[model samples]
Target: MAFLESVFAVIGDLTWGWALIPILVVLGIFITALTGFAQFRFFRRMFRVLWPGNQSGDPNAISAREALLVSVGGRVGGGNIAGVAVAITLGGPGAVFWMWAIALVGMATSLVECSLAQLFKRREPDGMFRGGPARSIIHGLGADYMWLAMLYAVCLIAAFAIGFNAFQGNTVAGAAQDSLGIDRIWTGAVLTVVAGFIVFGGIHRIAKAADIVVPVMAVAYLAMTVVVILLNITAVPEVLSSIVLNAFGLEEAVGGGMGAALAQGLRRGLFSNEAGLGSAPNVAATADVRHPISQGITQSLSVFIDTILICSCTAFVILLGGVYVPGAEAIDGVVLTQQSLAWHLGDWTQYFLTFILLLFAFSSIIYNYYLGENALSVLTESSVARNALRVIVMGIVFLGAVAPDATSVFFFSDPLMGVLALVNLIAIMMLLPTCLRILRDFRQQLAAGVARPVLNPEDFPDFDLDRTAWTGIDPDRR
Candidate 1:
């Protein structure tokens, strides 16, 4: 077991080495500059697009609210809570600063890639939406790179099936075991049954489940954190100071100095929102929108809400509860989060968080299965193979739930995911120009009051916006 873990560790380091961060950072900055910071510039318009019933009647896409919810289903996951705890445990309070910095940059990165995913998105024979680097790479880089695209899809399947889904399942079962002594097998079986129902129902059902669950779970988690922080409100100022000072190694207490803290935070932040990892793009691509940029902007907001809001909320609760011990061995996984919340809220809080994690873990199970199916679609033209892959993926949900501990589950997930990120980041860098050009054209039309929809790929040539003027206002326009 130890030898296998060591092998995975080496592979993880090789895949996620320090070299990629700067490259991703540079690409993030480049995209942000290329779009004239489109993420920030169009914030108001994006918010308007998100209003209920706005863009509701568009036949081409899901309601913007539903789009946002589905995206949220992907964004807010084990990472926001467990991922944050691991960051602070590994990097100290200083890591929190890095997390913020990553999110700021990540928002732009998500915008670019998701928009590109939108640009090349394909409608299935079944009338569902699917896009991402798989589509973008094939569309933008040409069919010659189909192998490279397939490679990306393979990596995605491996990562989600064994690594991510397992990690989420283990987190749920571990929490349940700790809180209620529920046998992991029973927990796994129950989760498998629940997940199979949602997984087999396909995207609209998954979107509906997410729309109902993500909001309620998110609000519940947030309210719990707020209560923990409010009880320790006096500690808030000190917690803020510690996070800032340690983030830069200005505090003598944190002891790791600046570099260590920053790495922990950046990695965990990336993990939490998965901005550059390309997983969220799979979810964003399913949004039933007429324009790729709409999903792109909606997804960018999700990055903020996921890392900046939900992940931050978790960090505050852990820190303010005084559960973060700088010298203790790295927290490694979700247990530290459970411990902190338990410490602050007592035994019953453990059960609540376990249930919350169950919701998070189950949603991710269905989501990861969907991502696997799309990745499978890229590889095989065979319906039988695709269906087999789905069955295999569903079977893994039980494997994930019954996993022994957090560290083992993480060991399984991190390396495959690291490779997935590396492949995805490469594709994203290649797709940046198309992303920039589309943004430029879209902005020009918006300014001219002639924002017509780019409904089809063939329309790309005739997508001249300077010719048409807005007639009656679209409600989403407000």
Candidate 2:
């Protein structure tokens, strides 16, 4: 076990430290330039597309709102709460500034990858949409690179389906045990049942469930943060200033200096919002929209919500209450957040936090399952195979909740996701011309007085596209 841990630790350090971080930053910047900073230019259009009642009218295709919720469920999770707290503990308040910086550039990366997903998405026999890095690489790049697509699929299954799901379940159970005096076994049993029922119903059920939960939990959590900020209003300016100062090595309280702040902030930000990781694109492909860029624009909003809004809320809660002790080894993760909240809102806040954590973690589990299912679809077409995989996913959920060793799970999952991100970034880079063209086409339509931009495959005959998928565009209008 020790040997395995050492091996994984080394791989994780090399994968994330030397490779993924630098590449992610460069690619994000490159894409941001390529798109004319679409994330900023189309910022208002993002919310306009997200307006309620924006439906594609395809029964099998999920509504734009449902798609947004699914992506939000996947993006906004334990990372927003526990992950943010860990960043502030290790990187000081300055870490929050780095987090914001990543999200700002990452919005562009998210737009490109998600737009590609929507373009290459295939309709399943059940009428549901299925696409991600695998489909995009295969359909967009060509069948010759199917091997790379398959490799991505396998890595996604290992990282999100089996490894990350276990990690999330462990987090939920640990919080319950700490706050409610519940046994791990009981927590595991309950989670297994609840997660099993929802996951087995497949993507539609998952989307429906996420639609209801993501909004309520996010709004409620944000409202709580507002209350805390109001109660500690005077500290707000000081807290904001410290974050900026610490990010640049100007603050002595930040241990390990600016390097640590940048590393932790970027790492946790990527983990929380998953901008360039290629994870969110899997779910983003499931949305029904007039233009692929519409979903892309909508998904950019998710990155903002995850890091800028949700993660910022966690940071303020910890910093405002004065519970975060810089250079202290004892406080971190959800515990740090919970303790800080207790300091401000009283001891009863701990129980409230535990409940919120459960919702956050459980919603993540559902989203993770869909990612694994998408990967499984690439490898096999059998319903039986998919169902069997679902059962195993549930078993992992139970095991994760009851298991004592979660370090191994994190160690294993981190490298796999790193590899997944590497492959996805490369593919997206290769497809940059296509993504840029799509954006240009969308902008032209908008300028020409089109209310909602619609994609026409004939616009780019040089590239391979699934024409049937874009047939929803009115022929007469064209």
Return the clash pairs for model 1, or none: 61-288, 94-246, 94-247, 163-413
lDDT score, candidate 1, position 240: 93
For model 2, residues 299-367, the per-residue Cα lDDT tens digits are 999999899999999999999986888887756588889988999999998888887878888788999
State residue 114's C-alpha deviation in candidate 1, in Å: 0.6
Clashes of 1: 4
Report clashes for each candidate as comma-separated counts. 4, 0
Best-fitting candidate, scored by lDDT:
2
Q: 1-478 in candidate 1: lDDT tens per residue?
A: 8888889888777867755667667777877887788778877666666566556455644565666776777668888877888778777888888898888788889988888776666777776677777877887778898887888898888888556777676778877887799998899889888877887777778878887888888889999998988899998999899989998788844556788798888888877778888888887777656556767887888888888788988999888775667767666557778778888989678788888888888777777887888888888768788767667765677786786853354564667777767877888887777676777666665677755444334435533221121122354543
Best model number under TM-score: 2
Cα misplacement distance, residue 380 of candidate 1 (Å): 1.8
Q: What's the C-alpha lDDT at position 449 in model 1?
A: 70
Lowest-sum lDDT 10-residue window in model 1: 463-472
